[model samples]
Target: MPAEVDLKRYSKRFANLKSKKETPLTARIQIVGIGDDGLDGLTGQARQLIKNATVLVGPSLLLDKIGNTDSKRIVVGSNLQQLQQAIKELGDSSAVVLASGDPLFYGIARYLTETFGKDRFEVIPHVSSMQLAFARVKESWDDAYLTNLATQPLDRVVDNIRTAELVGLFTTESITPAVVAEALLDRRIDYFTGYVCENLGTPDETVTQGDLQSIRTQSFGSMNVMVLVRRHGAADRPSGSAQRRLFGNPDDLFLQSRPKRGLLTPSEVRCIALAELSLTPTSVVWDVGAGSGSLAIEAAAIANKGKVFAIEMDAEDFALMIENAKMFDVPSLVPIHGQAPEAWKELPDANAIFVGGSGRIVPELVSSAIKRLTSGGRIVVNVSSPDNLVAVQQVLGDAAMQPDVRMINIARGQYQLDRVRFASLNPTFLVLGQK
Candidate 1:
């Protein structure tokens, strides 16, 4: 039969069947996950439900299978709203929604249930792409860290991945496997074996495996799953190295410059100032007069996924900032080598600002930086001298919105040989203001 004739006959048959069944049909919805092998991949019950559905909806790629449907058919590219509307319009009819892989594993089942209530539909899940990837690789994913790059920040994902022996990630356009590998390589974390499983569970399925260095120079197809397996004994040495029980970290971790040796803000003071800054994972922060960038570096670690702009006027400290940022694996900390207030121009307003300076310009710098703070933002100043404190308090106290101040006297215990002695790093005062 001719193609046009077949379509006409098919439509007539559907109309005839509809007229014969005059009884009111019960309204129902079914979400089905189809694999690369198409409908044959479906289970017995799932296939039967799809075959008898009165209305079918799915992405254009999946809709090709039921294109000859005698019932209503809708092809959606990416408009989820249109799909929802079509589902709503298919009231009192047996409607089936088609999706790729398992519908519930990071799929549409969750959204559909949330949007239309759980009792209104049934979901038939299939083999998820992650399961298939693991099967192909012959590896168990019982302990692997899994996350979606599409919804999470790449920096955060990389940060959490530091301790994982194995990781499985769903990559987005901006965070492809190559980009992820590059990020890891930049942090000197290059001991993982990388793999990209493309077109999984299909005839043209291709799995490309390589080390982080090799993967950093490769490309992958759109449909793929990224996996990372850290080599044995390749995990971060001296585990819990990032965690600090006390307020201070070992001074050696920081990239310190000579002549400015003691100028680096002690970690004890930096900890209190950071806490006063009200740091959060998403907070935008600035560290002015960031000597050796110690405060900003530690602040960056505390605010893992947040943005930290470390502005330093000294040339040597600015260079040290970059080295410290790399050592800490904090890609979000930006080292700005210029004077404050003027250096912060063109950047987004900060949610928190930390000022550490003993210079004569402390008062003016704090006042200028405070103006760029967002509403409800916090400002913390660490000043050692009583004169600088008085100067800053005078300006801040007179501002339209004045901040609260506190004096922090931190003392640490030192044990040399068999004798124990108390060593006071500094008696720095912290002033906190909110806008």
Candidate 2:
């Protein structure tokens, strides 16, 4: 019994020693997130850390808010390299680096941690101004696209805002809320309700709510966070430029049902399908299973003098298709809200047909659709599964159409954490046949 007790004790001691060696010690350099309200906004622990800090580092504005601290101060400026050197000179001294809002959220902590490994510094975050802005407007930000105008360009930011359902931006002195609002209006993106929260967490805090047009003309304080919430059921407007392309518009430009977003034919696939159709200026085109009218609208733009029918079965998707067609301003595009074969009974014979969907009945739909294709006209079928690919090929073969098959594999490049990553779309197969 005594031997067993001794063995357990020894094992416990060894485990403790192993854990100590494995666990990294808390860093001496503390990066604390502070607000405009300064010391009063800090937690007790954060306040004590600042009070006991041997050296303090922050912007001149933030250092001014520290009042009379005995700790040595180093002011941060545009040159971050100098700040890094100052922090490095502190060596073994206990130092506190102050930042605005959450230190890790587009703040200096990322730079500091990258310069001198994460193990050398501990970060304590406060409520971000962006969070306060959303809270003031009573909106949830978990899914909001948050960015900083200080770090990213305004044009790129406005482009991203075009498709986002919700957006939060940290407005800089130069790129204030009014400036951002103006830029958005310049792009004709006026669907969102804008809110500018200024001097958050301070006595002089103000929250201004208005439309993008009103916000554009109004002046705001330098310190502000802008929040934009897209209006419900509002379709994104097409680009206001007259130089817009006739065909192959970007997939995002169309309004698709949220749950059925991926149902729309990708731009690359749509371009290939449209090309295969060999549409004439006055060709009658049918886009069967057109979820959001992406292909139908583009076809209408190409066949300006002709008619394009977008047939969709789902009621919600049909409504979305109508909205999308209007947004694209394709007057020649007509939406038919019913299943195939029956839907096209009253319609004219099509010069070109594009069949797109992943249903098991796609083979049957394609077979029926080809019957409506005029002699010497083209038909293109887009399918994702190999089974459907073979089935469609067989149907075309039975009609002696001699289908030409092509598989499309696309990978779009995405920028993440200063690196380019490729996100691949599911491979799609296009089977083209001419009557």
Give the poorly placed runs of model 1, Cα more than 4 Å off: 1-26, 65-67, 237-435
Worst 10 residues of 2 by lDDT: 235-244
At residue 46, give the lDDT of candidate 1: 84
Q: Assess every candidate by TM-score.
A: 0.51, 0.79
Residue 392's lDDT within candidate 2 is 100
Q: lDDT of each prediction vs. the true structure?
A: 0.78, 0.87
Off by over 4 Å in 2: 1-27, 252-263, 278-284, 290-293, 300-339, 346-348, 358-364, 374-377, 383-411, 414-435
Candidate 2 residue-wise lDDT, 1-435, digit = tens:
454467888999999987785654544799999998998999998999899998999898888887898999988875798988888788888899989989888889999988989889989998988888898999998888788777777877787787788999988889988899888888778889999998999999999999999999899989889999998866665455445567877776777665345677999998899999999889999999988788998999999999999898889888888877776789899999999879999999999999998989999999999898899999999999999999999999999899999999999885433346797999999999999
Model 2 TM-score relative to the real fold: 0.79
Candidate 2, residue 355: the lDDT equals: 94
For model 1, state the Cα shift of residue 421 in Å: 43
